[model samples]
Target: MEALYATTTGLLAACGVYLTLRGRTFPVVVGLTLLSYSVNLFLFSMGGLAMHGNPAVVGAGTPAADPLPQALVLTAIVIGFAMTAFVVILAMRARGDLGSDHVNGNRLDVSREDGK
Candidate 1:
């Protein structure tokens, strides 16, 4: 189970980076979202995945999952959502004013054609 979680986290991070390197604004936003999700998963996993574990509390007998990671992840999710929303609005404004969705302020097809 740990191996599976690690593999998924790695895959998500890789895909996020790949998309972030694209020229388009939309893919960049999606990549940022994916990256944030991967981070959240990793943070949550740190709380441990144990069966029949007691709730995190002081002086609890036996094993108890750490609640700190869960709280941190929740806070991170809200912050990530706000960041994504702001970026998306900024992208829309840029597209409207610049007439292009590319981060470099030029269309990829046009730039490629000009290069050719």
Candidate 2:
């Protein structure tokens, strides 16, 4: 279970970074969101996977997962939401101002060079 989470989290982060570098606003925004999810998953995994139980409660002979990681994950989730919202709004504003959705500045100027 732990290995699964680690692999999943790593894949998310890798994909997010790749998408973020693409030459488009939508992909960049999506990548940002994916990255946030990856971060949350990574933090959550640190608390360990439980079977429909709270990490704060320890069972007989079994120690409960660390509470600090759980707390950190919660905080990260909230912050991630805010960050995603901000990035989305910024993308929208950029698209509106530039009148072009493409990330390449040269693409925007091509029309001027062609006199069209």
Candidate 3:
């Protein structure tokens, strides 16, 4: 299970990086999201994948999963969502202002047509 989890996280991070290197805004945004997801998963896994474990508040004999990672992951998820939204909005604004979605520059046709 640990090996599988590690492999999955690595794959996600690799794919995210590959996509992030593309010359477009959308792919970069998606890549960032994927990378964030992989990080979240890794952080969550650090809390241990206990089977049939009780809550941390339980006082019984059996071990309980660590709650810190879960809480951190939850906070990360919310922050990631907000960050993604802000970045996407910024990208759209840039696209609208620049008349193109390309990260580097607008296409010749678009530039010529827009008289930019």
Every candidate's lDDT: 0.89, 0.81, 0.89
lDDT for predicted candidate 1 compared with the true structure: 0.89
Order of quality (TM-score): 1, 3, 2
| Cα lDDT of model 2 by residue, 4-113, tens digit | 87899999999999999987789989998899899888887765577666446646455565788888988998888998899888888877887765666445564665
Model 3, runs deviating above 4 Å: 106-116
TM-score of each: 0.86, 0.77, 0.85
Candidate 2, RMSD to the unseen true structure: 3.9
The collision pairs in model 1 are none
Q: Is candidate 2 or candidate 3 better by lDDT?
A: 3
RMSD, candidate 1, Å: 2.5
RMSD of 3: 3.8
* Per-residue C-alpha lDDT of model 1 across residues 1-116, encoded as one tens digit per residue: 88999999989999999999988899999999999999999999997866677887778776788889989999999999999999999999999988888887777674685695
Best by TM-score: 1
Q: Summing lDDT over every window of 10 consecutive residues in candidate 3, give the lowest-scoring window.
A: 105-114
